[model samples]
Target: MSDILKGLEPERVFRYFEEICAIPHGSGNEKAISDYCVAFAKSHNLWFRQDEANNVIIRKPASEGYEDAPIVMLQGHMDMVCEKNSDVDFDFEKEGLKLRIVDDMIYASGTTLGGDDGIAVAYALAILEDDHLAHPELEVVITTDEEVGMDGARALDVSDLKAKYLLNLDNEEEGQILTSCAGGMKSRAAIPTRHVEWEGVSAVIRISGLKGGHSGAEIHCGRANANRLLGRVLMNLNKELNVGVREVNGGMKDNAIPREAEAKIVLDPEDIQRAMEIKNEFVAAIADEFAVSDPDIRIELNVECNENRQHTIIHPADMERALFVFIQSINGIQTMSMELPGLVESSLNLGIVRTEEDNVNFAWAIRSSKKSLKYLMSDQLQYLAEFVGGTYWYEGEYPHWSFKSDSKLREVVASSYRDLFGKEARIEAIHAGLECGLISEKMPDLDIVAIGPDIHDIHTPGEHLSIPSVERSYRLICDVLSRLKA
Candidate 1:
């Protein structure tokens, strides 16, 4: 364990968290972490399996008196979204996260803290390694690549053993017991491009500093997506300057709302001053518009002469249609659930926009609790992409976990929480996607409930894990396990 987290309660859990932080375990890069878990199982004399997808399942037998109890599975994903500040020179593939603590929260230096599911892995590891903990025959299943999509969980084979009850440790908020979660899929539209040589005044117009967050969890916050905002900026400029876009690029993942976006544009030399004035106008307007949700939104500019230097640029006509696809698209909360108060039933986020040589690929992580509404949003995107002569496709589709009305595990968890926290844990459904969705689909008989410590600003560089919440949640988990011995 690192000296900074040495004496924290649940020593084994923090020790394992420090160990996980010391390894590079980002999405699509989980071999090292998977191997670490296998080694732990080997050293602890537990049966384990590591699949080709890098998903690990470590099993421990029940304690002497609890052999008759039903099997329980503790689950979490092994991967973290590798996001960092553009200025930070951190190599996620080569180096581990640099962790720091500010009072009660633990954060990574200019990178994601990985507490979204790392805490889940650490809790499961600590439970598996502790011989005295009164869990039933435990199946500690840790999957990978959950951030991009649930690729690992989708490929997992669950025919080995039986687990009637499964507790997912991937929930972010500490006090909420996630009973249901929305389904999701990746939507990509490759807009075919035609290039032209344009030599004139060129500038890189950037929209940045917006409080980008997870497309699902925080989409309702009314934060401005930098990629879409960039499109709006160009549309405003083209009315006077007739700007031709060279290459528009923004965002990193299909699951995170872009914090920064920039476009290289070609325009007439005389219109340069007008463009600046237009940018300033929109800056003031957007700042006032998103003041409450995205207070730090900014639009910046840097001009240069592209004259005498021929460059490959997209035709102004084609680029204008692409901009329209962004500005006129349906994004954010599409419909609110009347059944559940304050629940978002359907939504989509323009999570990524990239300029390729042949096309500009726009990808979104579409989400909805209702399957019909989910595909309806996809249909809308398809029409927009085809209207602009672009090819549209979708992948990484996953199912949803519905709310269970009769659950013995929920009552056990609630009773345990009240015993420890002096109040009932909030029973609710999150709009975000969870592996429980897929697991419940595969193993329909399993009673699954998702819970976790307080994870703030997940899928972003500002992510932090609450220290006290971890300690409390671990206590509640242990109590629940002890009570489930029947």
Candidate 2:
């Protein structure tokens, strides 16, 4: 707790947010938080249920005079992405998030703050307790494992819910309503590695200091992918000199852009200086290429002899094929939206690459508003993998929510926002994957609109929430509920 957010109007919301921070509720480990919500409902004497998938739904009767209004569902995920700084010692599964207030923002120390969806959960809890606010039938649906997959939302029995309209509290920006989002699928390739004896010096090539971000949300920003850059360096080295790769690894999460990558290779002693020269040239080219997005790119090389080397290096032919395929893989925004100017409609991210004892694995994720485009991208990746003598696989495919131009609830929300703020509000769509896509599949006719307070750097260590924006956003939500009852 800091002085910056001490005097906020939504004291109850902040209080619950703080309480949730103290709990370790990472994406897959959400049982504790789910139980906590259920207990809170029982203590407050509100009707609630814990479904088979651990999704919680709390039902509250309408205010005295608003009983005739249609029911509205306040939706948000209960789980948060488990991400931390590379040097942070805190374990996401055991340790609570350490929150700090800096100026007008609230953030966690060396870890994600979970403000992406936690604020929505807190707001819904506070609203349920506030007897003064005017609203119709309220149903708070808190689902689990939304960060990894929309398992809870997908498993939900829509027939059990009475709400016809849903307000998803998962959007990152305030003053904007997200009407649609892209569908996505994970693509992976496996390349078998064969080791061969090497009689050459060993060196480590490392790439670091790149500004990485969310592959989906920040792809349109034109940030550099470290894995791809590293592959470029390897391809150049193989072309100019004789090198045998012993190990290569980079990046962790599939959803996040890679910041650093390193490779260990055995090469002739005479090629060490030439490799360093090429590394410098590659660094300069990358800096100029990603000047606007990643200006701090760095590449370095270290020469050292192996003292206890027991294994052989990968064959030169195999290394060349793998490096070439990796460098040729297209990453980032591939197509722009025709319907919305400057919006990315289809994109791909080369998320992770690793070398194990006998195989090399490459992981990628593709997101698109159009199903045909997604399949096209997948086919391209599979072709690349097959051309390089590897096998491709797909996982975690989810549907996209197509935009509905004549949504009744969208009209109501737009008019309500204009009346409250005395101006027009932006109704837009995002390229990132959202749980609404899966929820919509279950409830075809349910009207959905996602909104939230201003939050930045979600799914990363620098995540934070804007206090002022949150206060205003909460008030606006209440106004929307009031207008709905009228």
Please list the C-alpha lDDT of all candidates, in the order they appear: 0.90, 0.85
Please tell me which predicted candidate would have the highest TM-score against the true structure.
Answer: 1
> What CA RMSD would candidate 1 show?
1.2
Model 1 TM-score (2 dp): 0.98
lDDT for each residue of candidate 2 in 1-486, tens digit (9 for 90 to 100):
334345566998888888788888988888888998998899889999998888999999999888999899999998987777667899888888899888889999988899978898999999998999999899999999776657788788878787888899998888789999999988898887898888777788888777777777888888888799889888888778877889888876677788778899886767778988988888788888988888888788888784434438887778777786788887889899998998899999887899988778898878999999999999998999999899998987889987777777788878877887898889999998888898888887888999899999887788889998888789878888887874
lDDT of candidate 1?
A: 0.90
- As for candidate 2, its clashing pairs are none
Q: Report the Cα lDDT for residue 108, model 1.
A: 95
